[model samples]
Target chain A: MNLSWMAWTQPTAIFFIVIFCLLITMSIWEKISPGGGPRVGILRFETTRGDRLFLSLLGSAFIHLAWLLFAGSNLWWAMGVSILYAGFVFSFV
Target chain B: MNNKPFDNKAWFFVLPVFILVAISAVIPLMTVVNYSVQDSFGNNQFFWAGTEWFTEVLNSDRFRDSLVRNLTFSAIILCIEIPLGIAVALAMPRKGIWVSVCLVLMALPLLIPWNVVGTIWLIFGRADIGLLGFTLAKMGIVFNYGQSWLQAWIIIILMDVWHWTSLVVLLCYSGLVAIPEAYYQAARIDGASRWKVFRYIQLPKMQRVLLIAILLRFMDSFMIYTEPFVLTGGGPGNTTTFLSIDLVKTAIGQFDLGPAAAMSLIYFLIVLLLSWVFYTVMTNYGMDAPEKREVES
Candidate 1:
């Protein structure tokens, strides 16, 4: 019934502003350097399965969110174990 | 490759995510901002508090302790999970039905929700009834997560490792699978030792994914709450009181709005900053990736 808003203050305001500034700077850096990959850019990679990367990220996020909804705290522990198992794949699979 | 006409229509499908994220992320965020500067009493009575709570929270020892604890926990998790995941990846089958089975099995733990994971461990760690605690006692070991801070710490860390290692494993597996068999074949033809091959070939191939794994784990671990909260409730003392847990206590338990909002903002910024470092490091490493060739059949 009663809910208090607790997230607006000078520190809070300053913190978010700084985060946005940093994010903008990151975008600029990403454009300028582009990380020395194929130099092909997004349009060129449209031919490849680049869209799948977006699909995977979104899909994984949803999967985790679903897990959170269903299992609550148990989901985190399960996912924690899963991450370890996934790490094994990283090392030797 | 099918040179199908580029479809701008897919962007329409993505609109829901944009909307959803805006609602979930932005709305609560704005609400938090609103609370940070205002004072409220019962029945929606409110007044301007300005930055009073912010100054108090910033100067509070409790916040500092929780922040330190969270940082330490995240760092420890990164150290353990990243290497463990990589090791597991290195040991798995390259191509087989078994690979699929293993992947799914590993991913099963990840599919469970955070709170449920905590509940499972809570049940599993009881000295009187829990399998783990009972077994350890039977084997002449004393373990009590409910009372001892160290035990609580160990259980939480172990729970996290068990739950999240699979994510690292999956990421690393994908990275490993993407590697051309030619690299291994060439190493074999050159009589390279397994260790040498791993160090020189496999490690380099996996650097990008490993970096992503580390960053993801760090961010998640830093923000971890639900599981640990359900498990120990920030512990017998403040031993396990992570920053997020502390913020919740101050905000909800103590009803200290301004300070909680300030802490949340700080927490968010710290995560964002670390994530930026991770991205930068990964991108720089991406430059070193060689033009790989597939092995001929």
Candidate 2:
């Protein structure tokens, strides 16, 4: 259980903090809205808003990963791809 | 899966995505195509190279070797992860407060950044300070990832499995939870064995999620760069240098934009072709299962 080797750098701390904030935000939003019943999408399945959100985030991670792998790590292209992916999720999913 | 009235106005909803993807994928891809065919040294001056870079890259042993390595790595990962993930998912609790706890713990590895995962493992596998490395060393085993090609591959593969198996588990869990209670009840009434119940009922139900999981894992593993890059930096030799690593080395490290662009196009095409083959084969296999189709309909 020793964690003395763990370095809590600014980026690592911010990453976790942002994730925590996102979870809080999502929970609050879910409570306020209170409806995420599944709706049929292009993928031959029913997905809720939460599912779409998850898919969009996952897709964005892949897009960035691919961009880094193929293109250089400039990330402008990846950002564009992520924005598009999010739009697709919201509109279609 | 649904029967909604066809409407032309749906196109408007999809227009934004089209524009965005086009701007991101198409435009940059075209830039690569341009680079692949032309030569540029500096000052924005360029001359038509006329597929010289393409021929050179296509003929190179380095390019071929890296492509083979990438394919081998992806295939091994798929073979290992899919069944292992399914087994873990099946072993998990179907209902309880512990479900959330298990899911969160499983998903925690996935959320960490790729470079960070590499760094974590990098330190975690050091014989001097890291826990796993120290333990392994204490057992009279020499496990230096930095110096051994096989150890580097082993560590990378293990890291990938740890980071990605959760995704497969989550997807499979969702699919499993979605199964109607009637199926299980019917299985029980029919005195079905555990293996038969799983084969006829659970496996069919999990088909869609499994497809997705496989596709995602394939693509990700094929294009893996950051984690291994951070871990071995492509090795003690050129052993762990997969296609993406080599491409980055060429494009950025050596500044050979022409050959890199050519290789990039070739690499993209290979992935696209293989994925198409995988999707077609799996979907056709699904189609062959008449009972499954009837259930869906």
Candidate 3:
């Protein structure tokens, strides 16, 4: 297989490289500190650390999507909305 | 989980999420409802349309076609992603260092913005500039996403699978990990095959998270706009024009606010109704019996 035609743009390369680094770091972190025991928060559901991270990420996506749909493409406003969303998820969800 | 003592003060902590969702969801929703029944033709001048737009939109072949396309896309995505995600989750390491490594890698695609995902695919599928496209051409296969309807559909669907299957994997993995060791040990001691163990033990345990996964994917795919918009622009002769793309074309592209608003309300209702049906059907089955028993005890 010829690999000569590969398009290794800076952003694409950076994206994958960062992801690779994240995986390595996360593995090392998990190896060092093993447990992610579930804890009940204000949401009335038991969630682990990973669950909270997922919730925050999902919530922020919705925030940005909603902002784009309704408020138009003023990203500063969307960022503001996302920050509030993150705060709420981190605190309760 | 519902057995916690009544604590009215807990509402304070919940207030922020409620407010945030309301501001994002409810207020814009009301605006859409308002616009749906009113006609505006520049200069902020408005006249009461009184379902005229709704009648028009309902009667339009374009709107109906796009809605059908949207449903088909969502269905296809769910069928592909849910099983694929579950399989990936099952294959994932249950313990040790590799678990985090796999999780972070799987989650990487999801973190990238929707537009960026589309752009990546757009560049990656171009015959002149992309490896995939170039390789296909070299193999003497005609592949051009920009000009061919089928190719555009294929790319869009593939992009969605790449972007979202990870969500399903993550949720299922979480559910899988949460299963107690005792249950697995019991299954092992009973000499159950792997399929039997999954069918009886893992599947039932995953039902709740699976329901959540299904609902989220359905809603997101139903509302999908950015990725397909950036990729195909609802094009190659409107073959990939889902409801949101068509709605935006009506509202912003042509500046037809009344009909667009009507279409938006209809679109929102379809999503809400289907999600409700999915939630009720999934939760009301074998899941509810245990909860009822707990309450009785």
Better of 2 and 3 by lDDT: 2
Model 3 per-residue lDDT tens digits across residues A1-93: 642223223433463465468557656765556455466788665665565655555555456445545665555787787778767766775
Q: By DockQ thresholds, what CAPRI class is model 3?
A: incorrect
The alpha-carbon lDDT assigned to residue B38 of candidate 3 equals 76
Runs of candidate 1 with Cα error greater than 4 angstroms are A1-93, B1-24, B278-297
Backbone clash pairs for candidate 3 read none
Question: How close to the true structure is residue B153 of candidate 1, measured as C-alpha lDDT?
Answer: 90
Q: Among these predicted structures, which one has the highest lDDT?
A: 2
Which candidate, 1 or 2, would have the higher TM-score against the true structure?
1
CA-only RMSD, every prediction? 13.4, 15.1, 17.6
Docking class of 1: incorrect
Interface RMSD of each: 13.7, 16.5, 17.6
- Every candidate's DockQ is 0.14, 0.02, 0.01
Q: Write the per-residue lDDT of candidate 3 for residues B75-116, one digit (tens) a residue.
A: 999999999999999999998999899999999998999999
lDDT of 2 at B217: 94
Question: Cα miss at A6, model 1 (Å)?
Answer: 9.9
Candidate 2 on B1-297: residue-level lDDT in tens?
Answer: 235554669889999998999788865776676677667675566666754776678668999899888889999999989999999999889899999999999899999999999999999999999998999999999999888889998999999999899999998988888787889999999999999999999998888778878988998999999999999999878999999999999999998888898899778777765675565556555445446645753
Clashes of 1: 75
- What are the clashing pairs of model 2? none
State each model's CA lDDT, in order: 0.73, 0.81, 0.79
